[model samples]
Target: MKAFVVYCHPSEDSFTRHVRDSFIKGVVDSGNEYELSDLYKMNFQTDMTEKEYLRDSNYRTTPGLAEDVLAEQRKINSSDAIVFIYPVFWTDVPAKLKGWFDRVWTYGFAYGEKSMKLLQKGLVLCTTGHTKSELKKYKLLESMEKVMLGDRLFKKVHDAEFIVFDGMTKACDLREKNWNKNLETAYQKGKNLFAPRS
Candidate 1:
């Protein structure tokens, strides 16, 4: 199986980067192939150009998408599954990734008269500074899931999942305590991503 991994992280000295590496290792160990798009490293353009906005707003399928946007679309079509790895910022995806959705998931491709394929799976792995309980306490987790799984990824993939590694604040004791465990979970998720379940 092949997976397209969209990794968005600004700093290499971060736990989120480690998660990405661990997951990639698991994918390799499972004998699966992957294509990685390190958004920050690639300096991917996230802002939608005026022309892009005009095209989507008018629902025009003029095949005028930018080369970068088309490249991302091609990656999606060529993969069996899609994996998104990032660190949560302000209870939502980082602005870079959100902008990616804005640009890459164009109207014709992800919505009306869509030609995008229904992939086998869509997985989101996000790290949060807040603990899971804290997130649930304010219903932030549910809201995050709704936006990601219920809306953005909705109908775009056959199956989708949102997984967060919480309590990763720099000051939190649990951050260091659970670091290995969190990465192990990430690795396992990658290993079993394409495995059949009965």
Candidate 2:
């Protein structure tokens, strides 16, 4: 199986980058092929042009998608599984990724008479400054999952999961404490990407 990884972090010197690399290594070792869209590195255009917005709002699917958007859509159709790796910013994905959705999830592709293929799995591996317990205390974790899994990946993938590598902010002691453990989990997740969930 092939996995399409949408990685969106701006810095190379980050725990999130380590998580991404470890996961890719595991996927390779498991004998699976993968494609990567490093949004920052590739300078992915995330903004939705006025014309683009109008087209979606009007439910127009006349085959005039931007090349970048079309490229991302092609990646989704080709891959058997999709993986999203990034850091949580303001209780959500970074702006670039949000824009990626806005621009790429056009009418008749990701929604509304969709042409996108149903994938085997959808997985999110996100790092956060807050602890999972803290996010749960305020129901933020639940909200995040609902948005990502329930809305975005819903009906697009047969199986879906959301994973947070939490408490990794520079000011948090747990950042250092959980570093290796979190990376190992990410690697294992990739290694078992195609395995049946029990």
- Against the hidden true structure, what lDDT does model 1 obtain? 0.92
- Model 1 root-mean-square deviation: 0.9
Q: What is the TM-score of each candidate against the true structure?
A: 0.98, 0.99
How many Å off is the CA of 186 in candidate 1?
0.6
- Candidate 2 regions exceeding 4 Å error are none
Error of 1 at 146 (Å): 0.7
Off by over 4 Å in 1: none
Tens digits of per-residue lDDT, candidate 1, 23-139, equal 999999999999999999989997989999999999988887999999999999999999999999998888899989999999889989998989999999999999999999999
Per-residue lDDT for 40 in model 2? 99
